[model samples]
Target: MQHIVTLLIAIVIFGMIIGIHEFGHFIVAKLHKIQVNQFAIGMGPRILHFQKGETEYSLRLFPIGGFCSMEGEDESSDNPNAFEKKAIWRRMTVVLAGAIMNIILGFLLIAVLLCTSQKVPSTVIAQFAQTTDATTGETITAAESERSGLQVGDKIIAIDGSHIFSTTDLIYKLQTTDAKSFSVTVKRDGEKITIDPVTFHNDNTEGLLDFAVQGKSKNPVTVLSYAAKDTVATAKLIWMSLIELVSGKYSLQDLSGPVGTVSVIEQAASTGENVLERVQSVLNLTIFITVNVGVFNLLPIPGLDGSRFVFLLIEAVRRKPIPKEREAMVHFIGMAALFLLMILVTVQDVSRFFQ
Candidate 1:
């Protein structure tokens, strides 16, 4: 039951994201008075379809993805209203709009998340293990255990004298270091307080104590500042990830398509403690995918939007439009190659998902 609901959520989210993409082209094409044949959701045979005026809108059999089939989109059309018949500038706008929309959507979503306070963990010692008090024969705050000796509202600046970024980073240091006693630096209520490690784990995981970061919301500026920082950080992550992939530091297994994305949704649903956590995880994945979609589409590949811009630039340079047949042939070749590549990549995506 929950699985079905998750699937619906996945569809709605994908539709919103991809629909915005297609709408970019659709609206621009309409403004340019180009003839649009179909604005369909998905590929293959239509499962549900309708036509109003000249355009046929269809929901296709495969619910994986969608497109807007514009007249002369890839070739010159006889109709004066056809895409190829449109001016070079119009074509450029049509080609670039989808990617622009994706980027815009990413920013908007991030902003909304910030406005709603759907943020990373910022509270100190939000969760802790309960332990018994040996001296008083009563269960207290467990001041001597792994979560002990740490008071709330203490600002943490460093772990073992190393500056940390996120809560995850702080935990990583504790889980990675083997130091028994180290100086912890913090500012509690506007005073710098350095405390030696006192809490110790039973299993000696990293041979460390569990002193948490003390977070305070004394000022509203902190929230805005954190939100702005993370939004930019999220955007930068996308840029860096792509560079990493091209540099061969990232592997193909790291790539995910619809299959892999769905698997991730299911995994997060089970693994996350709350709906917000699951949503954040899914949105994080979506942001990466969205940025990749924008980035990949902007690449100068034959079938990509970037490649269309390239062809247009070439025509502009020569001061005459490229031959219709020549351009058509190139698009034909490009699309065929792209389709084959999609099949290959889809197979790889599914194989890795199962594995």
Candidate 2:
């Protein structure tokens, strides 16, 4: 019964995000006077559906993803307000609405988390990984209390001379960084100080401060910011992390697929001290997965939203859509490639499960 409930909750949460994304497209298309043929929350065979006023709203059986089918997305339609008939700007809005919705939802979630009193980790370094801020990077910890290294109570004052107040800002600083080491200033135990290191503290690149923030509160906290902060930061992290794949930062051993996620779910259920913890774990897992989905979709490969947007941009520039046949072929090839890639990832996932 517990497993069943967990699965149902997962489905609802995942489905809701996908539904919101598709709904964004559906609503905007309607606003622009475009005709939406179908608005679907999921893919494959329809589990339930109804149509009203030129739009068919359907709930499909699968919970993996969803779509909004609008007329003339590919070519011009005779209808005056159909997608193809609209100006390029309107079409771009309609096309980009799904991603925008995902970002909005992420922000909404963060806001909710903040309202609940979860302390979001700001740019402050709560604690370095077993090291002090004054002498953390390249200097060993495990010895003294008066050390100046990033410890469990340091608040990051600046990154490379830029002020950082929130997790979002810290993440943005991370993405644009090409510098070998970050010159970080911190507020440690209420005293202002500067810390320099041979590297920044993250994986793909070197960080000057090798530290983790320690939250005063015990619960998982989400920090909200203006300008789609969580989505952008999360996206940047994933892309940067992927780069590490070639540099031996990530190995097959670290990769996990669907089955692996389920394992975590089950483990949380068994290990959690209480129901709230279990549920929190599930929420955290869901957020992680969805953020990954948001980012992964942006990969500029065929059959992905990123690639589709790239194509749309080309169409906008040329003032002509690509031939449907060519687009379809590209998607077909992309599907095959992705399917093979999934198989490999799944294999990696399974191997890790047994190990």
Candidate 3:
């Protein structure tokens, strides 16, 4: 019964995410007077559909993907309201709108998490830990950060030149980097100071995070500020992960498709002991997934909005559009390649379930 409930929740969440993304393109195209042929909530064979005005709205069989199909989107058309007839800037706007909406939704979800939280997490060091010495049985400093010139009240601003917006950035930097020591920048006494070789090593653990961060009381200003910062941080994290993947730091097995994502959502939904805790866990994961979707879609990969925008950019510079057939063929090949990759990833995900 719980598994069924979790599956239903995952479907609804995915529907909302994909629907909002397609709606962004649909609404923007309509506003620019582009003729939309169909606004779809999913892909594959249509399970339910209805014509509304000039557009055919659809709910397809597969919930893996969705689309907002504008006239002349992949081919040339004589209609004045066709997508290809639009000015380059206008077309670029339509192509990028879907990503923008996903990001906006991520931000809104982050705000929801912040509003429900008891305190907002900050980057300032709140306290250090003390551990008993094994030899003397006397209390000794355990926080490597304190001995390395970091103060309790100091607000960490950056690590190795990368700006630290919140604890999210701090934690990410510490976990991902291979460095045992780092050049840390902090705001202390209203002045920024750089501390070099701030070593963070403990006797028991390999983790670099040795000190606790202060939590601010929830208020309008703090909530809004933290929400925005966290959103940017989440997007940055996604981009960094992509970079790592391209650099061969991560393998294709690390990738997740719809099935893998559903598995993850189920795990998150079942995490906490209480209902509120479980909801918050799901919300947190949703924020990450939404922001990741927004960032990933913005990459200049063929068959994606970013690729279409790139073509429009080239068109703008050359004062001529690419041949519709050639552009369509490129997208078709890219889409085929993407579908193959998704199938491979889905197989991996299913194998993991049994293991």
**Index of the highest-TM-score prediction:** 3
Off by over 4 Å in 3: 132-140, 202-206
For model 2, what is the alpha-carbon lDDT of residue 271? 60
lDDT of the candidates, in the order given: 0.68, 0.67, 0.90
- Using lDDT as the measure, what is the rank order of every candidate, best first? 3, 1, 2
Summing lDDT over every window of 10 consecutive residues in candidate 2, give the lowest-scoring window: 140-149
Per-residue lDDT over 96-196 for candidate 2, one digit per residue giving the tens place of the 0 to 100 score: 77767776676666555444445554554454444335654564443222143455656776777866655656756665567666666878667888887
Candidate 3's residue-wise lDDT over 116-211, tens digit each? Answer: 878899999898777899899998878888899999899999999999987778889998988878999999999999999898865446457778
Q: How accurate is candidate 1 locally (lDDT)?
A: 0.68
Q: What is the clash count for each candidate, in the order shown?
A: 0, 21, 0
- List ranges where model 2 is wrong by over 4 Å: 118-121, 125-146, 149-154, 157-183, 187-194, 198-232, 246-248, 251-253, 267-272, 347-355
- Taking all chains together, the TM-score of candidate 1 against the true structure is 0.66
Residue 18 of model 2, lDDT score: 88
Query: How well is each residue in 1-355 modelled by candidate 1, as lDDT tens digits?
Result: 8879778767776776777788888889889998889997766898889998889988876666678888887566689898877789988999999877877676666555555453334524443434566778775443343353455665556656665444534555555455665567766678877778645454323334434433534344655555444444444555556777888877766676676677677776666678786777677666655656776777787767888898899988997878877876877788799777667767987777577
